[model samples]
Target: MAEDAHGGAEDANVRGTPPGGRGSHISRDHAAGPGARGADDPKRMEGGVLVSIGALLLGMLLAALDQTIVSTALPTIVSDLGGLDHLSWVVTAYLLASTAATPLWGKLGDQYGRKKLFQVAVVIFLIGSALCGMAQDMPQLIAFRAVQGLGGGGLIVLSMAIVGDLVPPRERGRYQGLFGAVFGATSVLGPLLGGLFTEHLSWRWVFYINLPVGIVALAVIAGVLHIPVRSTRHTIDYLGTFLIAAVATCLVLVASLGGNTWAWGSPRIIGLAVLGAVLTVAFVAVERRAAEPVLPLKLFGIRTFTLAAVISFVVGFAMFGAMTYLPTFLQVVQGVSPTMSGVHMLPMVAGLLVSSTVSGQIVSRTGRWKVFPIAGTAVTALGLLLLHRLGVDSSTGEMSAYFLVFGLGLGLVMQVLVLIVQNAVSYEDLGVATSGATFFRSIGASFGVAVFGSVFAGRLSDRLTDVLRGQELPPGLGADALKSDPKIISELPAALRPPVVEAYATSITDVFLYAAPVALVGFVLAWFLREDRLRGSVTAPDATQTLASNPVERSSYDEVCRALSVLGTREGRRQIYEKITARAGYDLLPAASWLLLRIRRHGWAEPTALSEHSGVPLRVVIEAARQVEERGLALREGHDLVLTEKGCGVAEELAGAREESLAELLGDWWGPDRPTDLVRLVAELNSELCGSDAEQPYEESVPRPAGRVRPGR
Candidate 1:
């Protein structure tokens, strides 16, 4: 077993080694773990699962927050750095680097290990953040921001990848939905936080704020996460990585520059477009020949994956396009402060939070998920259409309703696409598949932002000219200046300001009108998506089957499976509480009871671990622990905790009660005379959240009696 586990495999294609020169070398043994099933299976909770997940989620938030946070601080940054001509690159640089590095990071995580890669990414992000904060010039700030993006991209992708490792697909809905909610929350929070920091502290604080929070996350992940080092041998496709990065850079440049910085037909724009195409072609050609492709071309062959990618792109396009202009409509047209405009966006974020959370829970409960995207994209298109109808006289409430509809639609579709793609791919391909989907989305956002910027610029210029007619502007003011310096419009003479504000409103609305068709395309694509079953088993995908196949292990496996499934549900939690209450000879509240159990289970734990493991507040855990200690249930010896004689008895009783409860829950439903395949039955029940077994790999048989499309459902 050790020999197989330690066997070395050569990876001659390795590139971009860390400073320590850790090359891409790995080995694996069947006795240690087998297949993607083993690799992707949830690691057994050793008292800190929630903590690890929380830390990873926070890290992802740092990445997501930076994307929007910088927008509010950009004007200040330009003023400080004095490079008005190069202003757009401040944001574009980060977008460009992030988009370029995303796939490379995903592939590297797959080649090595996710935990280490994630940690490295976070460190790089922090370093980049520090440099950005200290940058003296626009050139330096932009360069450092790109550095930040390299790490930021990895953090975003790797966080999701790690979640895949931690939770089975059947149970990932809530967590993934929560991740979506975080992204949505940050969309509103980032700008608000940025404005606060910029106004109260300095624009540099926007980057500096990541320092303490990121350090906490980094420390938590380093201490708690324990992904097994799987020895695997694979070549890293350096050429493919370079080609893909090159293509992404070119595409983002074109998207960011075309018709905004340069005219659409200009040589610069045309050259970048042609170069992007050439690099894309080259990337595809290289992937075909490489030992390991950054994005496996075979993924496109899967209908669901292909469809999801397309829909993700379209969703990003429409969503970003609308978001890019919504503030303009609220602030420039309606004459609200930047802060108030952000406040006005709250309805959208609220809708997103509610819809994403509710939809995820529903998907978890009932395996039917196809309806969400179909309805979501359709609603998204409808919302965009409504926004298109907004006039200069539209009320705040009217705009709020429009934002809510649009946000709800976005929320429903965002995480569901990732779920669909993950469901379609095998465990080994999870990271790359996710990164690929995100790459499309990121690129789509780039295109959306660019194209909409062009549309808004042209429309506003024409509107301003038409509105002004023969009227001359103040010295040093023109239509072009108004487009660039939006604040100047509010300072114009009352007669002139009304026309400019109306013109701004018209231009922004036109962008939304143009984006409505993109959502419609996504709606069409959502219809073509085939819903597959989510994986429900917490262990290796076929662990249930393997145990059932062995006659000697059948009875024991059945018991284990039943116990796990029961414990996985809400009612199961009630059962646990009852077990503890019954054993302790008194009413132990949920937090106190859970803390005692964890203490008993782990022998000793810090106060933080107890809180984290049990999902109790730290203050609650500390108070409960103190109360228990005063009652002679637990005592602290030095820094370690130990149970007394009474405590041990209570622990023993709780354990017995738990066994009894499991036995009762898994007991025969029908009379004992007729035997049932309880093991298979429990497995099926758990897997049911994933839909039918039609899409499961052939080797993993999901047995069903004849003539039932869905047997238990």
Candidate 2:
């Protein structure tokens, strides 16, 4: 018995390793305690879970902190290097590489284990940090930063994905509060840290700082992260990965370089643009055929997942882009120092902190995550418009209100996307699904920052040229170079200072004017994001582990089937009464069984055949079918008979333990995935919702079980 227990433990240990990695390199075997006990019992999932999660909290903070910290430091880096024109590339490069690689990390994690992949990401981050610190020129710095970004993408998402692996989604809110708090707190801290380094230490040390922090994070992951690993057949989808990477890179490049390094109408821009379109189409082709596609083409067929991804993309595009330029506005246009800008932004950060914490607690308690996004996206659009109207004469009070709106919107929608994606997918696909969501958002943020940076630059130039309409100065210095750096503007011969500042102000205002409508697109996308009913279950602590389908509960299945079969008989033809009686015993038998059989039959059989088989007249079956559905026994699928969730479960149980019975049913369906579809009961859902009306066009055009059909419905 002890050996068997040891073997089980051994098996679990092996499962923690992902598919093809340096095996067991970073498996943190500290389970949250098996049963409630002394302080040492780890698997109990009560107290020790908190301590480990606290460490996880710190680890997540490390990743979120890096994104914002670098933003405030960009201008300072340019000042030190005498390469003011290269500032946008620094931010663009980081986003471009990170955005493209985000899906890959998630895919690899799916092949291996989340624990190992996260550790690998930390190590890669550490290496990139060293390279960034050593960079001597603008181009080298941008290149190294891109490398750092590759590692950074996986760190943020894998941390969240790990939560789903260990805990249920409902209970995850308290922990999600930790994630929100970390993001909120870090936004404030990152800029402060960046300012401190730029002011006292060299700006290069900003890159160096990540080294020690990443090592500490690596140690925490080595000690406390615990998860189960199950060995399974694995296939990496190379064609899909290549195609996706190509399109993502091209799209980001277009955003980053268009209207800046290359004209919007330039041949280079047009070529990359066409290349991106072709790559995206090719990506769809690869996804369709790959057995383990990074993106399941079928997932797009799922309304909830696709809408959530779209909303996430649009939100990232508008929000991140707008926020990235906000600090630049404070420093360049308003003449606020970096430290002061970070402090001035406190109201926005505070609003995010408060709203997200409160929302997390409520969502944790109620297990409802859909409504927040529907409303939050609307709020976000309002904030974007408010920010759009900002200018040199805009009051601090007005600015604060705008920032508050932006913060509130972010607090509401940002984390909810994670919840929606988690709810919509099965457990086996958790890492990929979570990664897909984060990937789109990352792509959005990249485009947002890149495109907005160009807008800010262009507006600044136009304003500068307009303000200097009559002024003539140095021989070769054009308006573009003069307006490039605020520090240079401050030092520009004292006479040029006021006009330069005015030009900066005009450009900043123009950028805001342009940013307003971009945010509205996200608002419109969010409107279409469907509200999915949360499947209430025993397990739910966080977004990741909230929606795992329970194993087949055989006894419940048997009771439901027997009761339903008897109730269907003429001797006991009262399904409503049987359902009511079964409810008292917690059997839920008759209704569940009846629904299961109908779904299996799928109204594919003619009404006469169904009537003959079940021993009921066709007319009575049609009339009473509505009542049968009310009891949750069966569903009337258009003009045919179908089963609901309750019905499907009962039928599976009643199908019996005999191979002949299995063959009789299985042999008729040539579709390889039919068994999997049945197990998930994904098809048993309403065709209007889960299945497409277009997919069964042949069924519609030829005939239904009862009569001829048409294309539309």
Candidate 3:
């Protein structure tokens, strides 16, 4: 819904496949982190990995920036292209194409490998951008945008998924935090950048700008990126995907053109309505029987998933509708330059960032999420009502205040919607539920833009007609010309300009007034969402995951891995080691158990290196090594500690214990009938945790126990 760039992280690897093609059962040898796939792996090389990450970030930026940047340029585009009635189509087409293509891209990447798919996606996006820049008409631009959306959707999904492939679970949060920061920055910078390009350069520059960035990303990715490809058989739900897309298209068409483009009762609108109904029924039938349904029909039976989906749709409807038209109101009626219009929208972006961050932190801490959505929707409705008060003479300050209120309301709801759906569904449903929630939001955005456009176009036409009933216009100047381009008002007689400006202002404001009821619907629905105890993974999501604007498109395993990674990071070395040691029920100190597991994972652990890397004191590392050896768990070979046969057994037991402990946090998700993929995830995560130096146990500056002898002594 936010045109979030990192949608594909969850689907980075094929779901249900054992990580690295290891056996289905947990193995002691697999205890090494998946990051250790190959010594020559480019993703593991410190410098090369940075370069690769930079390329991925650039790819994500190309996609994300396009989503927000185009909004500010829409007014200029329509004016130049002379088709105000088709304005919304430009945005709707992109959203529709991207939303429909997202899952397919992710699945294709899993099948054919992401690196090649990623490059292909980049090329497609660049081609679309080039075509869009060269377009001469509204229809051409709209069609080109859909082409762009197809590639843009893949860029977002694959870039995020590739992160999972490139980074181990332990260090993933740090990098993902970077991705989240990018999303946040784009939210503020996108419109501003669009405004600058439109005013200083040309509207065409907005599309052209992506060319240089995307080409660089493509080159860098091709040269430096290398990830293993594991192909697995998949049954893609082609029919379900097509039907859903068709249904959404039909509904959006009805909303956009029903009253304005065609009479509401006209045959075209009636035909589309009936077609949409038929498509909906067909989609359900296809989904119920499809091997891998796009939107699993069973999820609707879950109350939380259903309610969250609806609320998400409403949020998307309200948020995108306001975003699409606010620029037009500022530039056309308020008489602000395109660049200044972007500047004036900052309050709303700031409000959204602040509230979303705060609400996420609060929910993570308190585990009560229902209140935010309820309050958010209520405030959103209020903000819409406040926006309705804007007139031709509304001050910049008044507009900023109203925008901030509206943004604050949106932020509170957006972050929690995914979390709600994830917490509600079973392990098998986690991935689809997350994607489905965002999918609804995306469809809502398409509807909102279309509906808002219809209202604005119809009202503007009627208002201009009423006000100019008896006015004498310059030769060739008419209401139609004024409707096509707001700039045409400047050519009108000085007396007529006032009525034209007022008409533009009221028509746009009335749209907000009409949309308030939509937000109110979300408010009422929020009251019905049942508050469940938060899963540990959902409790403390990485800052990037929490603050990111896009829907987190990940499989169940990746989602759990990410959550566990965050939890492991937040717990730090000492706490996690203590818990795992206790769960292991071994007759050894936590430090000694950690040493054995570490040695077993890597074959050997140098005491000094261990202390330096893990922040465990040199004395403690030596003492732990000595203890393991005294217990015959490990043996000293030169300066490194190597696991003995008994040590290997103990280490495997410790790893198993760690896996069980991690699985316990999932609650019902780890039931007896848990999916094998989840079992694989738990095992893989345990191995990574044990092998990662970043996760090695650390003790604060504390003296060793009195009974423990110095290693030399």
- Compared with the true structure, what per-residue lDDT tens digits does model 3 show for residues 1-713? 00001212322231222222112222322233343335433223656667999999999888888888998999999889988988999998989988888888888888889999999999999999999999999999999999999898888888888988877665566677677778888888989999999999999999999999998999999899988897856788778889999999999999999999999999999999999999999999898999988888999999999998899889889998999999999999998888998999999999988998888778876788989999999999999999999998888889999999999999889878877888988877787788788889888999999999999999999999998998887775788888887887888888888988999999999999999999999999999999999986675343334333234467777777777766666776666766776676654666777787666554577778667545667877887888888878777767766777777767777777777878887888887798887776666566666645566565665333333323422
For candidate 2, write residues 1-713 as lDDT tens digits: 11111122222222222112111221212111123234323234434456556656665666666677776677767655545446666766776666556556655776688788888888887788899888888888888887887777677667665654554322333455466456656766887887677667877778888887777778866886677764334587767867876787788778767887789999999999999999998888888888877777777876778887877776777666766677777777676777776766777776665665566556535767767776777777777777767776677788888888888876677667765665676544544665567667766776767777777777666677776678776754567566444576754667777777777666655665676666566667677766665433211223221110000011111211211222122122233323322332323323233333333423232344444444444554453455445656455545544555654443443332111222222222314453453332211111111111111111112221212112221
Candidate 1 wrongly placed segments (more than 4 Å): 1-58, 71-92, 106-120, 130-143, 157-185, 199-202, 215-233, 426-431, 467-469, 531-713
Local distance difference test scores for all models: 0.63, 0.57, 0.81
The reply for model 2, stretches above 4 Å from the true place, is 1-58, 82-86, 107-116, 157-181, 219-232, 356-375, 393-395, 416-434, 474-480, 493-495, 529-532, 537-713
TM-score of each: 0.65, 0.65, 0.89
lDDT of predicted model 3: 0.81
Best-to-worst ranking by lDDT:
3, 1, 2
lDDT of 2: 0.57
Per-residue lDDT of candidate 1, residues 163-242 (tens digit): 65664322443455456556766877976787678767998999999999899999999999876655345687778878
Better of 2 and 3 by TM-score: 3
Best by lDDT: 3
Ranking by TM-score: 3, 2, 1
